[model samples]
Target chain A: MSTTLTPKSSPIDSPDLRAWKSASGGGDTSQPPGLLSGAFLQETLAMTRRLFIQLQRRPSTLVAGVIQPLIWLFLFGALFQNVPQGLFGESSNYGQFLAAGIIVFTAFGGALNAGLPVMFDREFGFLNRFLVAPLASRYSIVVASAIFIAALSIVQTAAVITLSAFLGAGWPDPLGLALVVLILLTLVLGVTALSLGLTFALPGHIELIAVIFVTNLPLLFASTALVPLDFMPGWLQVVASLNPLTYAIEPIRYLYLHPDWSLGSVVLQSPWGSISLGVCLAVLIGFCAIALLAIQPLLRRRIA
Target chain B: MPPAVLIEKLKKSYGSVEAVKDVSLTIQPGEIFGLLGPNGAGKTTTIRCLCTLASPDSGNIEINGTSVVDDPKVARQSLGYIAQEVALDPVLTGRELLQLQADIYHIPRKVSRDRIPQMIDLLELTDWADKKTGTYSGGLKKRLDLALGLLHQPEVLVLDEPTVGLDIETRSAVWQFLRQLKAAGTTVLITSHYLEEVDALADRVAIIDNGVVIAAGTPNELKDRIGGDRITLRIREFTPDDEARSAQEMLARLPFVQEVIINSAQGNSLNLVVEPQSDALLSVQQSLKEAGLSTFGISQSRPSLDDVYLAATGRTLMDAELAAVGTRNLKKERKEAMKGT
Candidate 1:
C-alpha cells in the first residue's frame, strides 16, 4: 500500500544509487510477490480489461457477429416460409421454429472463433511478453479469453431473442428465458476452451484457421440446429443426436415451446435412448469438463 | 556475494542441429556483460536459458543466487528481458501496455500509478504515451519496450540485440539509457553481432562461435593478449599475385615484422602483424619503395576484438554470419523459440 515517486535521476550523476531502494535492497528478499491471491486477481482483471478495451475500440467484430446471425435468421426463415403448416412442428411459422436453432448456432459459431486472436498472439510473438512476466498463474490467459467470449455471446443472444420476438416467435416465459442463458453459457465455455487449446497446439494461425473452416459448418449441419433429428434418415439421426450442439439446442427449444416443463420432461429422443432435461444439462456440463481437461497438457507446455 | 547472473556449460539442440554446444559465463553485479556471436552462434539460446524462457538440456543458470531451473518464478522476478523482436499489442496505447506489464509483475496498484509516469519520463516517451502502439515508429516502440522492462526495477536487465535495426540517433540514446541503468547498480547483459556495439558498451565480453565460448575477457585484455600492431599494404590498387607474394616475402625478413600474408580478397594486398613499438609501417613503405613498387595505401592499428575472434575462430564474424545464413532453419528455429517454459 506504500506508494512513493522517487525522482528519476540519471545513473551517471549518482553512481552508487540503487533504484527501488526499498524493494530492491535489504529486507525480505526471500519471498516473491506474484503468489498471493490478491496479486493474482489484480493481474487477471487487468488482462481481461485490455481485451474489453480492444473490443470497444474495434466494434466491427461485435457488429458483424450480431448482424451475421440476424441475416441468417431472415434468409433461412424466408427460405422455409412456404412449407406446409405444422410440418416443422408446433410453431406458428418457420421463422418461429427456426429462431431457436439460429440462436444456438450463432453463439456456437462465435465461440468457435475465440482462438483466432490467441493464435495471432502466438505468431506475432506477443505471447512471449506474457511468458516472461512473473505471473501468478498462466491460467489467467485462458480466463481472460473466456470472459471476453462470454460477454460477446450474451450480447448476440439478446439481439437474436429480440429479433425473434419481432418476427412473431413469441417470447419465452421468464424461467424459459433463464434456461436459454444457462444453456448459452455452458456451450460457450466448452467451445471457447477447445478453441484456445487449438491455438497453443497448432503450429500457426493458418493451420488453426483451416481447422476452424473445416469444423464450423459440418458440425452445425450435423446437429439438430436447423432441422429436428426426426426429419433426418435413421443413421443421420444417430449422428445428429451425438453432436454436442444438439444437446444444447434441444433443451432451449424445449424451454421455449413447453413453459410448464419439468426436469423429468424428455427433451431429446436419440437413437441411443430418450434424454431428459436433467440428463441434457448433465451432458453439457460434462462436455465442458472434458474440454477443459483435454487442454491441460497443451496449456502446461506453453504456459509453465 | 552472489553473481548477478551465472550460466555454466549450457547446451540446447533442436532436432539434429546442436544450437548451443557448451557455454559458460558469470556476470558481476552492476557490470555490463556482452555476449558476442554471429547470427546463429547460440547467443540467443544462452540468453533464453538465463531468462527462464527455455530450459537447457544440461546446465546451471542462476540469477541473483537463485537457480533458474530450480526456482524460475523467483529468478523471473529478479530479471527483466527485452527480446530482439519488439512485440506490442497494436490496439493498446503505450500507457495501457505498461499497465499490463505492471499487473503481470504483480506491482501493487499504488506503486504502479506512481512508477508508470516516472518510467515514461525516464525513457522520454511522454509525447507518444497516449498513442496506440500500432501507429508507433520502430524507434518509439523499442523505447516503450525498454520502459516496460524496467518498470519493475529488476536487479538484472537482459536485452537480445537491443539495437539491431535502429537509426544512429536512437541507437545512441538506447546506449546512453543502458549506461544509466548500470550506474544505478542494475546489472545489464546484452548480446549483439555488431562488433563495435559490444566494444563500446561491455565491461567484459565473451566471444562465442559455433555454439562455444572461444574467448572471454575485457576488450583491452583480449586485445593485449593478441599483442601486435597490424599493417595492411597494397602495392597498387589491385596488385598482381606475384608482386603481392614478393612483397610478403620481403616484409617477412624484417626483424620487427612477425608474419605476412597476401590477402587475395582485397586486391592481393599484403597484411602484416608486427611487434608493438616497431616502426613497421615506415619499414614496409621503405622496403616496397626500394623494390620499385609504389605504395597504394597503408595503415597501422592495434589488434581489435575482431583480431581476437579471427585468432580463435580462424574466420571473420561477417564470414561466419554468411555461413550461418546458409545453414539456418528459420522455421524450426521459430518453433523452438515458441516452445515455452
Candidate 2:
C-alpha cells in the first residue's frame, strides 16, 4: 500500500484524487490483515453506533420493552393474586414468583427482535453496502446487533426487577443481582444468536416474524416462568425441565427468595433430579455456546 | 498501467435465471465507462459481481491488477459502489451516514474530517446533511448517495443506474459531477439504460443485451460502426398501420435510404436508416408531400447509441425495455435484490 501511495504524489496522477490522496493521509487502503486490528474495531463500533442512534431517535421498542414486563407483573399478577400462598413453593405472593418469569421472558422477547433491523437492512439493500465495503470482518454486523440487543435486554430486565421489588419480590444481594445480570446476559446471548441466525437463514422479514410468533408464546407457557415445575403434570414437568428458560428463571427466582444462596444451592428440582445454581448457569452457558456455533454456517453463507 | 477496472468472462445466475453472462470490460483511469442496456440486460448483475456484492459463478474481476475474488478487501478499498436503490438509514442524518461510510472504508479520521464536509459541499448536501435521510426528496437522496460513494475518494467509482428515477435537474447535476471526477482522474463505471445518459457521459460503452455484450466502444465509435444516419418520420402523432407501411415503402425506395422500419409501438412511426451525408431527409419530406401526406414530425441526424443497439439486437432499446417488463418477475427480482444480486 505504501508502495502504491507514491503514485498519488506524482505529477501525472489521475485527477480529482487530491482529496482522496490526502484524506487517506496515513491510514492507507490496506488493512492490518488481523481480525482485531484497528480497522476491525473501528468498523464494528461504527456499525454499533448506527444501531444506537436508531434506538435513541425512535425509542418505541425500548419504551414497549419496559412497559410489556411491567404489565405482566402488575396486570397478570392481579389476575392471579388470589392463588393460595405457599402453594407455589414458599413465595408469599404470585407477584414474587412471576417477577423472575417476567424478567426472563422480557429478555427473551427482546433478544428475538435482534434480527428485525438486520432483516430490514437486508431487504432495503442497506446490508449490501456493508457487504461491499472493505470491512475488517463481517462478524461486526452480528456483534453490533448482539451488543444493541444485550443493552436493551438489560434495561428491560432492570424495569422488571425494580417493579418486582416494590411488590415485595425481595431484592437479591449485591452478588445475587450480579448473578441475575450474568444469567440474563447468557440467555440474551443465546437467544440473540438464534434470532440473528434466523434473519440470515430465512428469506425475508415476514418469514422471520412467523417463526418468532410460533415460538414466542408456546415457549413462555411451557417454561417454569409462571408456575413451579412441580405444579405441572408428569409430561409437562419433563417439558419445562427441558426448556432453557426454566434454567434461567429458577436460578434468578431462587436468588430473590434465598439471598444467601451459593453455587451449590438447589435452584431447580426437575422431574429427574435436583439441579444446583452452578449447573443452571452451566446449562445457560452451554445453550449460548451451541447457538453461537449453530449460526456459523448461516453467517458464512449470508455475510461472509 | 493496469486497467482501473477489469472483468473477464464474468457470469452469475440466480437459481435458474442467468443475471450476467459473458461480460468483459476494461476501464482505464480518468475515463467514464458506461454499461448501457435495458432493465434486465445484466447491467446491475455485472456491477454487483464487480462490486463484490454478488459472487460470480465463473470469471475473473480485478481492480488495479488485484483479483477481486481472491483479495476482495483490497479490491473493495479501490472501488466505491453506488447501488441503483439509495438505501439509507432513515433515522441517521446524512452526515451520520457519511461518517459510517467513511469508517467502513477506514478513511483516516483526520482525513475524513477535512473530507466529509468537502464532499457535502461538493455535492450541495450541506443543508441536508444534518437532516434524516427519510425526509430527503428523491433528488436529495440521490445527491447524498453520490456524496456517500465519493466520500472515500476511491480509485474506481461504480454507479448502478445512477440517475434512474431522478428529476432531470438532479440528473444533470450528477452528470456534471461525474465529468469533474473524471477530469480529476477517478475511473468511473456507470450503468444506464437511458440513451442520452450514456451518450452524454460515457467515454466508452458496452451495450449489454440479455446477459451478453453485443457491442462496446466509444458511443460515437458504435454509432459510426452501424454506418448510417437515422431519420424518424411520423405522418401523424398516431399514424395508422397502412399509412406507416406506405411511408416505410416510399422511404425504402429512395436511392440513399438503406433500410426502413415501422415502429408500431410508437404509433407506427417510420424509422429510416439512410446513407451518411445524404440529402434523404429533404427528399423524404418532398416525397411525403408529393404523396399528399403532411409530415407531423421529421428529424434526421447521425445514428444514436439506440440505433447501434437496434442494429445489433434487431430491436430498439425502448422495445427491448417494454418486452423485458412482462417476462421479468418483479417479486422474484426484489427477493434477488435483497440477496444483493
Candidate 3:
C-alpha cells in the first residue's frame, strides 16, 4: 500500500507524540469482555455518571418524581377522608391504607418512565456514540439505566413514605419497612427491564410516551392501589386481584396491620386462593427474571 | 505488518437502494487515506461498515489485522471514529465529557489523569474545558470532539467530514492536527466531499460515485492520468447561450483542443481540455479572434480533483452535491433505520 512521494510533497512537520504514546493503552482483546468484568463496570459507571450530571443540571425529573405522587396522596386522601367506619376494615383512615399503595405505585411509575432518557439518546444520535464504542456488553447501557432509575425510585419512595406517615399513616416496624423496600426494589427492577426493552422495541420517544400514557393510569386504578378488591364489583375485583400491584400492595398492607408478620401468613385473599407473602415474593422474582431474559435477544440484536 | 485497514468487496443495501455496491480498500500503516465522494455516493455507508455501525451484506473489514465482522470488539479497540455531527451531551462540561469518553474506552485512571490534560492542550481547549458544552461554539464543540476521538490513541482514526462546516482557522487547525496524527504513526482515514480537502491531505484517495469507486489514486496521479491541461475561457462575461455554443464549436475545431464544455452555471464559461505543455491557450485565443469573438477572460492550469471527478462521473461535484441536498435526509434516515440494530 506504500507509494513514493517526492520531496516537494513530503510530509509536514509535526508536534511531539510523547503525551499520546504515554497515555496509550489500546488493550485490544479478541474475546468479548465478561458481563461483570472490570471493563463493563467502568463503562457502566461512566454512563451512569453522565445521566446523573444531566439530572443535576436539570433536577425537574427527580423533583417531579417525588412531588407528583404526593399530590395524588393529598388529593385522593382528602376526597376519601369521609369513608364511613368499617369500610376499609383495617386502620381508621384512608391515608393509612393508601400509603402502601402509593409507595409501590410511585416506584412503578418512576421505573416505567426510565426509557425516556434512552429514547432521547437514540433520537439525538448520542446513543450511536456508545453503540460504536468497544463496550464489554451492551447490557452496560441497560444496567446504567437500571442504576439511575433505581436511585430515583429510592428517593421518590422515601418521599412518599415520609409524607404518608405525616398524613396520619403510622410507620411500619423496622423489619416491616425493610420488607417494603425489598418489594419496591423488586417491582422496580421488573418494570425497568420492560421499559428499557420498549426503548429498543419502539421507534422513538413519541411512541414510547404514548405507550406510557396508555399504561400509567390503568395499572394504578386496576390494582389495589386506590381501592381494595372487595370494594370493586365482581368483574373489577377479578382484574384487581390479578394485577401485580395488588400482590405488592396486599403484602405491605398486611405488614402494617399484622405486627408479627411471617412469610407463611396469608397476606392476600385473591380470587384464585389465599396468596401468602412468600408466594407474592416468588411471583415478583419470576416476573423480573422473565423480563430480564426476554430483553436479552432484543438488546443483543440492537447493540451487542 | 498487516495493512492498517482493509475493506474488500463490501456490499450493503437498504431495501432496493444499494448504498454500497462494491468497495475495496487497503490502507497501509502510518498513511492518510481519504474517501472522496459527493453526498449519497455511499461514502458514509462504507464508513459505517468499517466502524461497525452497520453490517454489510457481503464483505470483509479488518482493522489492524482484526476482522471487524467476526471480532468487532478488538477491531473497535483499534479504530476511533469521529462522526460528522457533534454528539456530546450538552449538560456535561467539556472536561467531564472527555472523562466520560476515557472511561468508556476503559482508559485506566492513572493514564487518563495525564491524558485528558494533554488532549485539552492539544486541541487548545484548556480555557473551555471546564465550561458546559451547551455554551460552546461550533468550532469549540468540534475541537472537543477531536480530542475525545484521539484520547485513546487507536491505531487508526477515521473522521467523517472532519471540517465540512468550519471557519477557515478551525479547518486549518483540524488539517494540522491530522498531519500531526500521521507523524505519530497513526493511520488516518477521512471521508469528505470537498475536493481540495482530499487533495490537500490524502496520501491516496478513492473517488466514489453512485456506490462504486470510479477512480482511485494520489491526487496528482489522478490529475496526470486524466492527461490534459484544463483551460476555462468565456466569450463574454455572462455569455448568451448562442455565443457560448458558437465559442464551444470554434474551440473544439482547434488542432490542440481535445474537448470543450459550456459551464452555464458559471456565467456560461467554456471549459476545455487541451494538449498538455502545448501552446493550446494562445492558439485558441487566435482562433477566437479570427471568429470575431470577444474574450472576456481565459486561464489554464493542471486538472484539479474536481476536473477528475467531472471526467469520471460526467458531472461536477457541486452539481452532484446540490442534487443530493434536494433529496434531503429523509432517504438518509430511511437508510439509517435499515441499519436496524
Candidate 4:
C-alpha cells in the first residue's frame, strides 16, 4: 500500500514521438532478403568501420606497428653492421638481407596480435551486442578483424620497405616488389586467422595475451627471421626449415636478391632438399588454408 | 496474430549447473510481461535462449510464430533485446554507436537517417548524442542503450532489468516510455527482481525460483489467489516479549484472522493475514486495545506480489535474493554466457 503507482503520463510530448510509433509500423519485421550476401557485407563493413574509427582516434597502434619495426631495422641491423658482406648470403650489406626478414616478421607480429582486440571485446561484453543482433553471419565478426589487421600489415610492410631502402637495401624491381607484398599478405592472412581462432577458443583476454606472449618471440627466434637457417645447429635447422615463417622469409629474400627471379628459383637450401621460390609461396598458401580450415570448427562452436 | 512471444519447456544447462531447468511463458501483443526472479534464478539464461544468443538443451521458442531454432534470423528480426549490462563502445560517440547498431540491424540509410534523430530527441539525448559515450553518466548510457534497442522497432522488445541501477527520475522516465510503447502496440517482455517494479509495469508476470516457474498470472490475480489482506500492527514500537506473544495468541484466535506471525526483525511487530473486509484495520486496533496493548501503528492493505512470492517459495524475495548472491559463481556464469552454444 505504501508503493507509488507507475506514472501514466508522458514527460516529453513532442511531434518526434509520433516518428517512433510510425517507424515500427513502417517496415515489415521479417528477415531481410539476400541475408548471406548483402546483409553479410553490411554487417562486416559496419564492424570493420568501428575498428577503423578506433584506429583513427587512437593512432598509437598504427604508429607503433610501423615504428617498432623501424627500431628493429635500425638497432638490430646495426648490431650486424660489421659482419662480412657475403656472410649473410651474397648480400653486400647486412641491411639488404635483413630487410626481407624484418618486413615479414613485422607483418607476422602485427597479424599475431589480432586476437587481442576481439578478446577485449569479449571481456567487455561488447561482443554480446553482435551475438544478440541478427547478424547475417557471425563470421562477419571474425572477417572484420581480419580485414583490419590486413590493412595494418600492409601499411607496416610499406613503411619497413621504405626504411630499409633508406638504409642502403635497394628496392626490388616492380615485379619483385609485387611478389614481396604477396608474400606478406599470405603470411599475415594465415597468422591473423590463427590469432582470431585463439580469441574465440580462449577464456579471456589474460589467457589470450599469455598465449601471444609465449608464441610471439619463440616463433621469431625459431624461424629464419633474425638469422639464416645455416647459422643454427642441425637440430635447430630442422625446426627452422619446418617453420612457415621460414618459408615466407626465404621467398621474399630470394626476390630481394634476384629482381628477375622466377617462381622456380631456389630460395632455401634445407636438410630435406632444395626449396624453390614457387614452393615457398605454395607452402604459405597451404599454411593459410590449413589455418583457416582449422578454425572453422571453433568459429562454428563459438559464434555459430 | 500469433502470440508475440512463446517459450515452452525451455531447458538450458551449463556443465553441471542447470541454469534453466524448465521454463515457459507466453506474451500477448501490446502488453508488458515480466519474468520475476532473484539473481541466478535463470532469468538471463531464459532471455539469452529467446534471443538466440544461447541454444536451449530442449524446448521450443518462437517470436511471432516463427520457430526460433528453425529460423532464428527471422525470429531475431522480430525481437530487440536490452541487456542487463550496458555494453557501449566507450570510444565511439553516441551517434556513431547508434549508426553502427542501425547498420547491423539492416536499417536502410534513408530510414535510419530520420529515425536516429527521432530517437535522439525522443530519448532526450540530443545534447549528448555527439559526445563519446564514456563521458555520459549511468542514466545517460542507459538512455542511449534504450535508443539502440528501439532503433529497429521490432514487434517484441525484451528488456532485462532495465532499471536496475537507474535513479528515481530515470526509472520513472523509463516506466513512462514503456507505457507509451505499450500504448502504441509493442509487446514488451522484461525481467526484474524488484517486487514493486514488476507490480507497477507488468500486465502478467511469471515468478521463477530455482530454475522453475512457480507461479504465473496477472499481479492482481496472483495476489488475489492468496485470498487475504496483510495487516502490520506495532503494539508499542518496542513491545515487551510477553505482550507481543499475547497479542499474537489473541490475533491467532480471531475468526477473521487466518494467520499471525511475530516479526522480530521489525521490533516485534505482529503481522496478520486476514480475510478481506471493510473494517479489518479498525477491528485489529480494537482487538489490540481491548487486550490493554497500545497501538503504535496499524494498517491493512491488499496482498502484494511479495506475499504471492512468499506463498509459493516459502521465503521472502529479499531472503531468496540474499541466498542466491551467496551461492552464485558470477565469474563462471559470465564465461558460460559468452559461449554461443
Candidate 5:
C-alpha cells in the first residue's frame, strides 16, 4: 500500500539536506572505522563539554571543594597553634606547617571524588549513550572526568593557598608556587584515574561510594598531611612513607619552609631513608603512571 | 546495497539466563521493520546486540552489510539508535544535546549547522529546543531524542520502543514523522510491545517470544495466515457465566466457528473466531436467537495482530505480557544491558 508523497515534505528536496545525505553514504565494510580519523577528538571534546556543562549548571561541587579545605586549614591550624615552634620542625608556625597538608589533601579529595559523577552516569543509564555511539575510545569518558576534576582541583588549591597566607603562612616563591601546582596536578591525575577505575570495577555506585568512604580519610591521616613523620611511631612512619600522598605532601611542605628550594632539596625523612626533592617528584610521576596503567585493563574490559 | 539490517542466529546470555536464545530477521532498506514482543521476550536484548552495545555470545549482526560484531564502528556509523529510555543530559539544552550527538557521530560542522535546525523544524521543536532537557515534558524529551538519532542521517535508524510512554497526540506525531522518514528513503527499525504501534507503523514485523522469533512476516500476511474473522458478542454488560457458556456453545456449533473464548475481564464478552464470510455475524445472531439469547451488541472485523500471536503461541499478547511481568528480572536486565560483554 503506497501513499502519495508530497514534494514539500521530503527532506531530500532541500539542497543542504541532499548534501548531508551524500556526505553520509550508505555503507558496508569488513571492519569498523575508528582511529585513523578525527572522530576521536570530536567525541572526546563532546564528552568533556558535557561534564563541564554539568559543573556549570550545578556549581556545588566546585564550591564545596573549595570551602571544605578552608575549614580544614583554619580549624586544624588553630588546633595545633599552641604546639612548640620546633615541634613540627623547619616550619616557623602551625599555619605554615598545615598549609602544605591542606593543599595536597584538598586536591586529593577533589580528584578522589571524580568517579562519583561517572558512577551516577552509569547508574542513570547515561553512559549507555556513549557506549552505543561509535566512539573512537571509551576511555574518553574517563579522560573527560580527569580533565574536569583537574580544573576543579586547581581552583580549590588556589583557595586554600590564599587562606593559608592570610593565616600567617607565607607564600612560596614563584618557582615554589609553580612546583606546588605541578605536585597538585600530578596527585589529582593519579587519584582521579584510580577513582574512575573503581567506578568501572565496582558493581554500582553504592559500592564505589563505600570504597571511597573507606579510602578517603584513612589515607589522609596515614599520610604526612596532618602530622610530621617525626611525631609518629616507627611503624606509622613506614606507613606514612609508603602513602602516595606523603610523597606529594612533603615536597610542598618543603617548598613552604624554604623558598630557595631546588630539585635536590631534601623533602622527607622516611624510616628507610631520606627522600630528596628529585626523588619525591619521581615518585609522584611514577604513581600517576602506575595508577593510569593499572586502570587500562579495567577500561578495556568494559568499554573496548 | 545489502539489507539495511540482518541478524543470523543471534544468541546472548547473562550467566544462567538466555536473554536472547536465538533471533534473526532481515530488514530491507527504506521500510519500518518492527520487533514486537512482551517485556521479557528479549526485544531490547536483540536491539542491544544490533546496536553494538551488547555482544551476542554467538551469532552475527550486520547493519547495511557491516558486521556489528567484527566491525562495530562501521555498523555504528550506519545506525542511529534511540534507546527505549530517552537518556538525555538533563543539564544540556535540547540543541546542545543534539550538538553533542552530532560530535559523537562526527557529523561535520557545516552539515550539523543546517541539519540541526532542519530537524528542529521538522520535529516542531523550535520553541523548546533551547530549554534544558530537564525542563522538557516526556514528549519533548522523546522528540529531542529522535532529533539526536536523526542528526547524522544514518542509513538505518534504530529505535527501541519509540512510544512506550507517550501521550496519544505525540504518539501519532511520531507515527507521522516515521512515515515521512520512510518516504524520504530512510530505513527504520523499531521494537514495541504495543501491538497497535507495530500494526499501525511497521511495514514488516517479527514477533519474538521468550527470546526466539515465533512469527515473522508482514502484518497483513500474518493476520491472513490465521484465516478468520473476529466476532465479539455481548448478551449483556457483564453477562452471567451460564449465559456466556451457552453463547460459547451455540457459537461453537456453527460450521464456520474456529474458537470461542469468554473474556470475563472485558465485561464477560464472547470473543469468537470464524471463517471469513459475509453472513458470519447474521448466522451467529440467528443461532443465539434460536437459543433464546438476546444480543446486546455484536461486531465482526478482520483478525488483528494479537489474534495472529495467539494462533502461533496459544496465548494473546496481553496474557503473555501479564505472565512476563511475574518473571522479568528488571534489575538483572539493566545490569546486563550496561555490561558490554
Candidate 6:
C-alpha cells in the first residue's frame, strides 16, 4: 500500500515534539496558525487551482462566455449600422461606438455570474471541505473566486476587443488599451465581489439563478451597453447615471473615441453634472471597495 | 493526557427540533471508537460538532485538548472528517481533487507529491485516480473519499456512516482499512446504524438514542452487564400460544433460568434468560421432552449488544429505526447540514 503507515510505537515522546509532528502531519493541533499565515496562502492557491481544473475540464462556461459577448457585438453593431454618424457620440461608425459597451458589459456579465459556482458548491456541500480545513483565513475562499473570475474577465475582454477590431470598430491606442484593461478589471472586481456575496447570502442555487436572471438583462438595458445615456428618458438617464455599469461603459467609450483621452476628459454628461474619466474610475474603485466591505459579515458568518 | 477527541454537553437545534442534545463523549488516543445509533439519534450531529463543520448551541468540543469553538482552525487541523455524503466535484479528476485537499491542509509540495501516490496505492485507486470522480462507481468514490480524509494523516479520523451504501466486499475492505489505521496508532471515531459494522469493528462503542448516549463501554462489557445467556427455544414451527405459554411456564420454574418471554412475533419462540451453567442447554431440551412438546429448533448464546440496547432503551435498534423514519425531517436536516459554523 502506498499510504504511509506509522508503526505501533507512539509518536509522541514529548509535548513539544508531539505538537510539531502533529501540526506538520496536518493533525488537529490546538493553536490557529497566525492570521495571514502561510496556511492561508496554501489553501487559497489550492482552492483557486480546483476552480481552474474545473474550468479546464468543463470548457463550456468559457466557450459560452466568449461566444455570448461576440454575438452581442455582431448583432447590436448590425442593428445600428445604418444610423447617422456622430448620433451615439464622436465615433463615425456605430460598431466603433458599441465596442466599448460590449467590452465592459462582457466583463460585467462574466463577473456577475461568478457566484453561481460558489452557490452550487454551498448546495452540494463542497464548501464544507474548505470550512473544515484549518485555514488561516476563510476569506481565502472569497479571494480565490475573485481571482479566478477576474482572470476570466480579462481573457473575455481581450477576445471581445480583438473581435471588435475585426468588425471595423477601430482599436484603442497602446495607453488606451491599458486604460481599457484597468476599467474592465475594476468593474470585474466589484461585480465579482457582489456575486461572491450573493453566493454566501442566498439560500440555494435556484434563488441565486433567479437573482442573476433578473439582474443580468436589466442592468444591461439600464446601462450604456446597448444605448447611450443621452438617448434615454429623463428618469432612465438618472438611473443609468447611478448604475456602476454606466461609469465603466462611458470611460471605455470615451477611450475608443479619443486616443488622446486623459483622466480629465468628460465621459458622461448627466443631468446633474459632467462625469470626468478620473471620477468614473474612482466610482468603480469605490463600488468594488463597498461590495467587498458589504460581504465581510456574510463571509465571516459562513467561514468563521 | 487529553483524549484524542472530547465532546461535552453539545447541544444543537434546528427551529423546534433539537438534533443533538447534551451529547458527551471522550475518545482515547489511537482507539477505534464507534458511535452506534438509529437515524436522527444525533450521531452525525455530534460528529459535525467535533469536526468544526457546525457549531454547537452550547458545548465544549476539543480536539487533542484544544477547544473547537474557541480555536476551530486548530481543531480542524487535527481532524480528518469523511461526511456521509461524498462531495467530490465531478468536473475535477480524482488526482486533482486530492491535490486540492492536500493544499487545503497545507501539505508541502514535496510531501503532497509523495503522499498522493501513496494514498492512491493504499486505496487501490491507481487505475481510477486520473478520471473525473463523476464517472466513478459508488465504491470507487468512497475509496477516493477515504483517501482524501486520510491524506492529512489526522490524529483523529472521523467518518460518518463510512459504508452505509457499499457492497459487502467494499464494506469489508473499509473495515480492514480501519483496523489497519488503528494499528498505525491513529485514533478513529466512526458512526454507523449497522449493528454488525459496529460490533465487528469498534474497540469500544457508545449506543446513542434520542439525542443521548444510552450506553457506553466495550461491547463485551455492555453485553456482560446485561447478564445472562439467551436461549431461543421454538417448541414447534409456528407454535401455538398455549403450548408456548406452557413451555414458558415450565422454563420459569427452573432455578437457573432468570427470565422467560414468549415471543409471539417470531412464531411464539420462547426466549429464556438463563444463568450460564454447564447443563443449561441440556436441561432446557430435557424439560421440553418431558412436557411432550417437540423441540423444533433451539439455540443458546451470550447476550448480544442489541440486548444491551434493548435493556437500556426499552426497544430494539430495529424498532427505534422504524420509529425514527416517521419523525425524520430530511429537508430540515439537509438545511442544517448546509449551515456552517
C-alpha TM-scores of all predictions:
0.91, 0.90, 0.93, 0.94, 0.92, 0.91
* Poorest lDDT segment (10 consecutive residues) of candidate 2 chain A: A1-10
CAPRI-style class, candidate 2: acceptable
Off by over 4 Å in 4: A1-18, A24-36, A302-304
Model 2: per-residue lDDT, tens digit, B282-336? 8999998998898999999899898899889998899898898889997997676
Interface root-mean-square deviation (Å) of every model: 6.0, 8.3, 6.8, 4.7, 5.6, 6.4
* DockQ metric for all predictions: 0.33, 0.30, 0.36, 0.40, 0.33, 0.38
Which one wins on DockQ?
Answer: 4
lDDT of 1 by residue, B109-159 (tens): 877887888778666677888999999888889989998888888889999
Kindly provide the TM-score of model 6 when superposed on the true structure, using C-alpha atoms: 0.91
Q: Is candidate 5 or candidate 6 better by DockQ?
A: 6
**Which of the two, 2 or 3, has more TM-score?**
3
lDDT of 5 by residue, B59-105 (tens): 88888777888777777778888988887788999889888888887
Model 6: how far residue B267 lies from native, Å:
4.5
**Number of clashes in every candidate structure?**
0, 3, 1, 0, 1, 4
Q: State candidate 1's TM-score.
A: 0.91
Interface RMSD of 4: 4.7
| Error in Å for residue B19 of model 4 | 1.3
> What are the Cα lDDT values of the candidates?
0.83, 0.85, 0.84, 0.85, 0.83, 0.83
| Candidate 1 segments whose C-alpha is farther than 4 A from its true place | A1-36, A302-304, B233-245, B262-270, B281-299, B339-341
Please, what are the lDDT tens digits per residue for candidate 3 over residues A1-304?
Answer: 0111122222334334644564557544556687879989999999999989999999998888889889988898989999986788586789888888888888888889888988887777778778778999888887888788878877887887788889887778889888988888788888888898888777677889999999988999999888877788888889988778888888998888888999999987777788899999898888888888899876755331
CAPRI verdict (incorrect, acceptable, medium, high) for model 4: acceptable
Candidate 5 interface RMSD (Å): 5.6
Instruction: Estimate candidate 5's alpha-carbon lDDT, on a 0 to 1 scale.
Output: 0.83
The alpha-carbon deviation from the true structure for residue B29 of candidate 5, after best TM-score superposition, in angstroms, is 2.2
Rank order (by DockQ, best first): 4, 6, 3, 5, 1, 2
Residue A240, candidate 3: alpha-carbon lDDT = 84
